[model samples]
Target: MIERDEAAIYVDGLTKTFGSGKNAVTAVEDVSFAVAPGEVIGLLGPNGAGKTTLLKSILGLVLPDEGEVRIQGSDVYDRPQQAYEHVDAMLEGARNDYWRLTVQENLRYFAAIHGQNPAVVADRHKSLLERLDLDKKADTAVRDLSRGMKQKVSLASVLAGDVSVVFLDEPTLGLDVESSLKLQQELVRLTEERGLTLVLSSHNMDVIEEICDRVVIMSGGHIVANDTVEALIADFERQGYRITVRDIDDVVLADLRERFRMTSIEQTNRKTRFEIAADSATFYRLTDVMEHHEIDIDSIETVQPDLAEAFVELTKSSESSMKPNTIEKGDGD
Candidate 1:
C-alpha cells in the first residue's frame, strides 16, 4: 500500500450525496484511493455510476459530505491554493481556452495563469504542439480550428503549464483514430519523461488497458474494484475459450450449451466453432463430453479477457453487493 504522505493524489472516506430526503441520491459513498507519483490511473464506470461526482469532488468542484482529499500531502480543503498550485485538468474533453487567441497564445495564457513564464516554457509548448500535430495550427485562432483540433489543443494546454498532476475526462472524445493514438502515445511518454501523475477517465478500454498502471472501477456510488489492469482481468473467474471442431451436430451443440455458458456459435463448411466461459474443472468436463460425442477437435485457444470484460463483470457483481474491494498490485514485478 502507498503511504498517504507519499501519494500524489489521495482521497479517504469521500462521500457525496445530492438533494435531501427520499428524493436525494448518493453519488459517491466512502470512496478512498491513492495515486502514486508518475503513475497513470484509469477511472472507469457506466453512466450515473458516480464517476463525474468522484472526479469533481477530487478536483474540489463539488464538496463532499464526508472524507478528505489531498494533493501531494497538502489538504485540498485546508490548503486549496497550495494543493492545486501544480495541478490542472481537461474536463469533459475540453479546457477553458481563449477562443479568440491563437493556439500558441492559448497555451501561453494557460501557462501564465499557472504561474509559469510562457517564454521559459516556450520549448515545451512547441514540443507539445509538434507532437500533437498542431504545429501548423499554432498561429491559427482556436475558434477557426475543427473540433478534433480543438481537442488536441485542449490536451496541449493542460500540459503547457508547470503541473505535476493532471485529470483528463474523456481525453479522446472527439479525436480521430490517428489523433487518438497519437494522444495516447504522447500521454504515456509525458508520464514517463516528466513523471506526470495522471487520472484518466475514458470509455475506451483499449486506452485504459494500454496505458494505466492500475484501474479503479466504480459502480453504484462505490469503488467496486481497484487493481492493476492485468490483476483485475486475471482475477475474473470464468475464463473464455474458443474451440473449433468437426463432426458436431445439433444434439452436441445443444448439450454443450446446456452444460456450459456458450456463445458465438458459428458453422461453416462442415466445421463448427463456438466459445465458452468456464473454469479449469468445467473446461475438462467439456472436453470429456466432446470426446464422448466423437467430436474431432480441430483447434482450441484461450480467449484472453481484456479490461472491458473485467469491467462488465466487476460492475455486474457490484450490483448484488456494493462493497468496496481494493486489490493491490501483485508482487511479481
Candidate 2:
C-alpha cells in the first residue's frame, strides 16, 4: 500500500450522504484508499454502489460531509487549486468533449484550461493523436466524428495537458473491438511513458483484467475487496467444474443438489450434465458420493475462474451479508 503522503491520489475516511432523516441515502461511507504514481487502478461496483459519488467527491464536484481528499500530498479542500492542478477527468465518455470545437481545438482548449500553452505541448498533442489513430481527424469537428473517434478524442483531451492524475468512467462505452484494443494499448503506453496515475471505472471486466494493476470493489457504499486481479482470482477458493455422468437417478440428483451447489443441469437419455462450484475437498467428496452410488463419470472439465467470476462472487457475497441502510431510492450513485 502506498503511504498517503506519497500517493498520487489519497482518499481518507470519506463519506457522503443525500437528503435528510429517513429519506437520506448514504452514497459513500468511511471509504479510504490510495493510488500509487503510474499505477492503473480499476474501480468496480454494481449500479447504486456509490462509485460515481466517490469519484465526484474526490474531484470536488460533490462536497463530502466528512473526511478529506488529497492529490500529490496537497489537501484538496485546503488547497483546491494546487491539489487539482495536475488532475483531469473524462467522465461521461464522449460527452466530455465539446461538440463545437475541432479535435485539435478541443485539445488546445483543454490544455489552455490546465494552464498549459498549446504551442508548448504541441508535440505531446500530436503524439496523442497519432497513437490513438486520430491524427487524420484532428482538424474535424467533434460532432462530425464517429462515436469511437469521439470517445478517443475525449481521452486525448483529458491527457492534453501536463496532468499526472486522471479519472475515466466507461472510457470504452461506444467503441468497436479494434478501436477498444487500440485505445487500451495507447493508455498502457502513456502510463509507462509519462508515469500517469489512472482511476478507471467500467463494466467491461476484460478491459479491467487486461489493464489494471489493482482493483477496488465496492458494494452497498463500502469497499469490500482490494487487490491485484491475479490475487483476487486466486483467493477465490471455490473452483467451478462441468461434469458429465451416466446412470444417475432422480434420488441421486436430489442428494447431489442437497449436498452441493449445482447449476445448469441437463439430462439426455442415460447421460446427465451439470455444473458445480466447490472447493477441492468438496469436489473429492462429490466424486466419492458418485462412486458409492455406482455412477459412471463420463467426463470432467475444470472451468478456470477469471476476473468476472471473482467480481460476481465477491459482490454477491458482500450484498448478501450487508445490513440494510437508510438509502433513498433514485438518489445519486
Candidate 3:
C-alpha cells in the first residue's frame, strides 16, 4: 500500500526494445508518468502502440532494458517484494479465478493467500459480491456461470486481498451492454470506497471518459497527451457552427467565406444554409459583418466534439511527431 506523500506508481524514462539489431522493435520509449493514490488513469492507444508493454513493465511481468518503476516509494526492480506487496491485477478476467470454485469460494480462497483471516475478510467478501451484483451467483460454480459472471468473480478474487492498486486490461471486452454497464458502475464504486488506484487499458472511449481522472494517450510507443478528459477535449476540440439565414445574397456569402472558416454551404429558394467554425470572438465578428452588410440573421448553432474525436486527433498528432530511426549493428543486447 502507498504511504503519504508518494505516488502510487512512478515510471521514469521506461524504454523496452524487443528482438535485436535491425529486427528490434521499440514497444515503449522514454515514457514517464506518475499516478497518484486513488486515481484512475486510462491508457489510450491503438494496436501496436505500446500500452500493453508499458503496463507489463511496470507490473514486473516484463523487464525494462532501461529506466525504472517505483511503487509505493520503493523501486520495483530493486525491491520487488515491497513494491509489489499491494499490487494486484486482473489482466485476463476469464482465467484469473478457479473454474471449479463458487464466487464466494473464489474470494475466500484468494484472500486466504494474503494471510487474511477468513472471519475478518468474510464481511468484505459478502460486500464485494453484493456490490458487484454477484451475490446471487455466490454458490454457483465459476465454470457454470456465464462469461460476465465469471469475470466478476475473478475481479472479486483479485481485489479481495485489499490491494491498493488494480490493473484492469479490457475488463469489459465481449460483454453485453447491460453487463458492461454493471461492471463499470461496480468498478467506480469499489475503487472510490476502497481508495484504490487503478490503471485501465481499454478501447472503449465511453468507459475511459467516464471513469478515468486523466488519460495518457500513446502512439508509436510514445505518450502524445496526458491530461484530464475535459482538458484533452478542450485542447483538441473541433469548434464550429451552422448558420441558416434568409436572403443570404451572393455578396453576404462572399463576405462570410472571406472572413470565417466555412464549409457545407447550401442554398434553397429563400434561405441559405452554411457551416462555419465560430468562437465567441468569431461570433461577434460575424454579427458585426452581418450588421454591416444589412443582412437578416437566422440561427447559429455550435457543435461540440466528443471523446472519439479527441482520441483520433491526439493519436494522429503523435504519429506525425515520430522521428524515423536508422538501424546500426551494436555490441548491446
- Cα lDDT, all candidates: 0.87, 0.89, 0.81
Best by TM-score: 2
For residues 267-310, write the lDDT of model 1, one tens digit per residue. Answer: 99989999887889999999999889889999999997778888
Task: List the candidate 3 regions with Cα displacement exceeding 4 Å.
Answer: 1-5, 92-94, 240-301, 323-333
The collision pairs in model 3 are: none
Once fitted onto the true fold, the runs of candidate 1 whose alpha carbons sit more than 4 angstroms away are: 93-95, 237-239, 244-259, 262-273, 288-299, 322-333
Residue 120 miss distance in model 2 (angstroms): 3.2
Instruction: List model 2 lDDT by residue over 109-180, tens digit each.
Output: 999999999999999899889988999999999999988888899999999988999999989989899988
| Cα deviation of 254, candidate 2, in Å | 7.1
lDDT of 3 by residue, 249-268 (tens): 89768978988867579888
Counting only residues 3 or more apart in sequence or on different chains, how many pairs clash (N, Cα, C under 3 Å) in candidate 1?
0
What is candidate 2's local distance difference test score?
Answer: 0.89
TM-score of each: 0.86, 0.88, 0.77
| Native-structure RMSD, model 2 | 2.9
